[model samples]
Target: MGRDLSGTIRSFLIILALSTCCFTTAPPDLQARVEQLEKYYVEIKEHFEAKIIDLETKVVRLEAKVEKQDSLLADLKKGHKPLKENVDINQHCRQNATLRTCHEIHVANPSYPSGMYWIDPDGQGIGDPPIHVYCEMEAEQSDVKGTTSILHDSESQMDIGNCTEPGCYSRPIKYYASDRQIEALIQLSTYCHQNIMYHCRKTPLNFNGIAYAWWNDKDGERHKFSNRSTTCDQLAYTEGYDLQYVVDNVSLPITRIHFSNPFKGFGQHQVSRLRCRGKAKTEAMPRSCEDLWRMGHNLNGIYSVKGAKQMETVFCQFDKRPNEQDFQKRIGYQDIKTRPVYFSGEGRRLFMEKLIPIPFDHDVVNIGGAMDSHSGVFTAPSTGTYFFSFTGLTGFKGGVVITEFTFLSSRGVEEKIMKHSTISFSKLTTFNPITVQSTLRLQAGDKVWINLDFRNDATFRFVDNTIFSGWLLEEEI
Candidate 1:
């Protein structure tokens, strides 16, 4: 519309000039006609300029609304409830600061002691509600320095009397925080610690290779007191000491401590505390290297982050700053020595819908840890365009190797983005390999993977030299 109005104005000016020239060839009222024409042109120009200004203003407003709608849609797709009207998501924290975790609060205010504090992770008005968590601020100053948030702390000492029989165990540790919150905290942490102390008297930690006591760690992995060589010996002394053990797995948040009172009627056994705390990798608790870069960190090296699932060590590519949103996200896979066989037959045409995902089990370059080598799926760290390439050799059995590339959206919708097939005319044909490459735009939480077709009733296998790789091309701000 603006373009059309400008064209109209230009044509009017041209016609007015032509009229003025025609009148100049005649006599009397030429000067008067020119003055009137000039006045009319000025009025027309002002009218059109005003309309253009109004259009531009409306366009800006519409763009802003669209951007907001997009953000809200993304949150909803991630299973978040629509926010209440007029409520800003980032204002849930103290003083309207964007503090995502207790660690960030501690970093912002170093004087704040260990206590219950409210954190608005996943922002406010989303599915995630603001949760009050106990932050163990002392851990930052203690040994193994980092900020710690207490996920679970036993209320009182638990006693396990000598029950020589089996099946004696304590309850699973219940956490105050939600599972999502706990997972987020773990992702933000570099390490976790749990304090366990046993009050013992004239009783053995274990006997005859049977453990008298054990505790389940955060991941539910059981660790016996007798398993740690000197742990049982340390407990044998007259006075018990606090066994501050660093938790091996920081992925999970809760733990359960168990003690089988095998020394019933002989000695006593009691658990002092089962306090679990996660020490953050950094005070900032940035989720990605892009976050660190945005926070003004210029160093380029490996850094820990709260990844999509757990804590991930990713290389920060700060040396190259294509844009403010350009944080490194690259992954590569190779050394897939094992051959996976998929069988398909003519009658199995419908089975093509369920393509077998290829497992790129080795990673040569995983900068952002976005690719899961085990699952052969690349999860987008953020909404962005990414470059992906896969090269593989077919097995000696000359058969059709149909490969399908797929994209799983955040909304649980799967779309076939690309498909390639390598065929052999005969069994005598050898070295039939296939390669697929494409640039894909994916939203955060979207997954991409390569699948092989097993719909021809033949065994299909990709050779050992197969390579699958991808990297972030550009991020959407």
Candidate 2:
């Protein structure tokens, strides 16, 4: 409005000037008219400026309202509980409700580039606190996507050449995040990798199947810079020579790096940036307690899993029964025969090598149904340590009674485990009993039984006092 009014006033003044020029004199009312037009333009400009200011204020308020509405809508769509108005969802990566890592952020918003971000690796309210970290979100041909944590970067070279051994120089790695936080990330991740770069001088990293440099992984295991090969000869020949390697065999993180100068060569070396990345296990589904434990679950209690046949809940005693089922594996049996069983070594068998399995025909208890009373064999339902005990009495006849616990492998091979012998030479020692116990580790499908043998050619008689018992002790993961 101000501009239009000014243009109209200028046009009117121009016409008056032209007319005055034609008459060679100015009209008396020309000055008064111009002053009146100027006053009117000032009033119009003031009014329009006030209106523009008012409209701008209204737009700002509307934008604030829209932002609030968007936040509420997003929460509703994700089925998340509405947060307080004072809470800022963007405070940390996990605070976004769905973005646990920077990789997830990049996935949610593809246009987001890699940079520093606040990440709560252990989730929003558990484990370690949030920490700032750099992320690498660049898309590559391999289609690999994950959050990367920088461990170490050698901005300048450092030489270590005074000694001559596999670990001539060792340095503990300084990671960007705490060890607990990194371990939490590894548990949540399906696959993890670390990139390593080494710059060597005149001496090669490896020669004639001997490595001069290696690093220890998160589990304190050593991994050579090169296998039993001379590949480093080609890569680390000159001062500027370098080699890049990726560690992905195990999901564990790296804790330290080492270099060696076995030949005492005139060479120097420097390690470049070490970055680790982990891909989230979005599809992880644990089917057993072992699986849960492997996934970083450390608590013990009743948990559900896909059992041998169907879904079932079992007690997870991670400290001992790591892979045990809900039912206890225990069995006890005894030979409850009315007639006396006789064992004669005179013509039946040799002195020590020959053995006969005890026929414990009566069962006292078979909890897990792993022991067979008919065959007198206890088959291990799972791989674990077990305890077995046997008690036998020489009824009335005096003889040397020897008994032992033997293991029958799945391959049908028998191995002696534990043995006990009793000497009953007189009537006073006729009732002497032999008790033997042992703890053995058995694999799944392995079988165990008791064997009887006589040390001498004397006959030994046994009654219903013969007893055998076994139970699972601890399960292995």
Please report the candidate that would top TM-score against the real structure.
2
On residues 1-477, what C-alpha lDDT tens digit does candidate 2 reach at each position? 557657766866676576557445645676766676567656665565445444544554454456656666777798987554422434533444534455655666654444445665555554466655555666573344545554343323446545677667776665656666666556555556665556554455666677767788877888876553344465444444556667773635667777765544444444433344555443266666656655445455777665434455555654433323542222212432111111111111222234656666566776667877655678887777788887666544466776789899888888888877777666443666677888888888998877776655545455346677877766553
lDDT of 2 at 49: 45
**How much is 78 displaced in model 2, in angstroms?**
30
The sequence of per-residue lDDT tens digits that candidate 1 reaches over residues 1-477 is 758787887888787887778786867687778787878777776677556545644564454456556656766798978553212332445455545565566666654444445664433333355665544555535443224444333433444544565327465666556655555445444554444555554345566676665677656777766455344343355654334334443424436766554544233222222133333344467876757744545556777777554565567766444233444653322421011111111111112223756665456767666777766788887776788887766653455667778999999999888888776655553566678888888888999888877445445354546677787766554
Measured against the true structure, the TM-scores of the candidates, in listed sequence, are: 0.39, 0.49
| Colliding residue pairs in candidate 2 | none
For each candidate, what is the lDDT?
A: 0.56, 0.58
Candidate 1 RMSD to the correct structure: 30.9
Best by lDDT: 2
Kindly report which residue stretches of model 2 are placed more than 4 angstroms away from their true locations once superposed. 1-99, 107-111, 141-143, 153-157, 161-166, 207-211, 228-240, 261-286, 289-303, 314-401, 405-453, 457-477
Q: What does each candidate score in C-alpha RMSD? A: 30.9, 25.3
User: Model 1 — TM-score against the truth?
Assistant: 0.39
